[model samples]
Target: TDTPVWVKGSGAASDYLALHDRPSITELIATKKAAEVAYKSSSLTAKNIDLAEVHDCFTIAELLATEDLGFADKGDGGNFASQERGLRNNGDVTINSSGGLKSKGHPLGATGTGQVVEIFKQLRGDVEKGRQVDDAEVGLTHNVGGSGATCAVHIFGRSPND
Candidate 1:
């Protein structure tokens, strides 16, 4: 059995907050909620993930994503992205081995699927050298649109045959 996209998204409560309540920009409640749903649906947690591809419309977006996606603790996203901890292609829980949306030319509507393609290659051991996560059995993709108004989180894993 092949693993298809196990996806989830944020909803109303956070939507209201994003508009008026304005709790905390760093919180990224919308993205965080979607991540929660995705993890639950996949029966996995951030620690269980082997790699991830996240939106990086700006540098700070990556930081928010890492924490919201559960790869790092609250307020630790910056350090998590730093060199000491390694989220590089070869590190534990490798992040953005595909060079992410920024390097991929940020093709707007295509960014989400592009993230999927990277995860597909990584899971199938088909990506080029120096950028494939070693033995990546599970991966995630995080995509958000227009100032955090919409978010999508997806979990992918190896097929039973693979």
Candidate 2:
């Protein structure tokens, strides 16, 4: 399940804060609520997650992502980053270790797949860099556009049949 909200305009820096008042906060709350519902209604378990690739359009986005994905709590993303809890090759839940839009690159048409590609490699342990999680069996991806105007989130893992 997914929830979408509409804002007034282009959501600039000041506009973003005014509109969402800490987008990460909103995302964290949503994430937790979603997880709760998912656990009670489905066979999925959060502990099964092994890694993630998020829309790190900027360093700040990476920070916010961990919380949004339930990897950390509100306001703890920065601390997690500082402590290197989301880096590839390290952290419990690797976030954007692919360099994301911040480092690797961002191709509009291929942006979504690029993010997924990283997740695919990480989950398959085929990554080539300092950001490879060991034996990642599950992965996630967060894609957003225009300062969070639009977002598409997805989860991936090794299927039992695979």
Candidate 3:
């Protein structure tokens, strides 16, 4: 607790259990609702985020997250991710610098905690070289479950005022 990362805001939401019951195939309503609350409570928009550790159990999930979280437009996530712009210090926000769930083996129950740890270290500049987001002051972690039936979004800052 010595190296503190402030929780600026947090939100959670849930939706239909089956993907087919959802209105869209490529988007998660739970994620969007959670993000809206988190962003509003933090008094920050997606542009204010320095980095994000989003649920990427699948490559498409990551892209969907980028859109749902407001990091990119509804359909531009693929483009945003492909341009090297999502890399550390390259664009509006660095994404998945920890290699995300796909690379981190999902970790099932511990996935959200793992994301928080990554953000904690990232804010403190304690991560391995080449993976740290330069000057990371505000970060976000998006966790999902039940095949996008539920989602939790949290924003963290270097300081409460950030």
Q: lDDT at 148 for candidate 3? A: 95
TM-scores, all candidates, are: 0.84, 0.67, 0.95
Error of 2 at 93 (Å): 0.7
How are the candidates ranked when ordered by TM-score, highest leading?
3, 1, 2
Position 58, candidate 1: lDDT: 88
Candidates ranked, most accurate by lDDT first: 3, 1, 2
Once model 1 is optimally superposed onto the true structure by TM-score, how far is the C-alpha of residue 127 displaced, in angstroms? 0.4
- What are the lDDT scores of the predictions, listed in order? 0.77, 0.58, 0.91
Name the lDDT value of residue 48 in candidate 3: 91
lDDT of 1 by residue, 57-92 (tens): 889999998988888899989988884534344456
For 123-156, candidate 3 gives per-residue lDDT tens digits of 9989988787788899999999999999999999
Distance from true location, Cα of 90 in model 3, Å:
4.1
User: Which number leads on lDDT?
Assistant: 3
Report residue 77 deviation for candidate 3 (angstroms).
1.2
Model 2 scores a C-alpha lDDT of 0.58
Model 2 earns a TM-score of 0.67
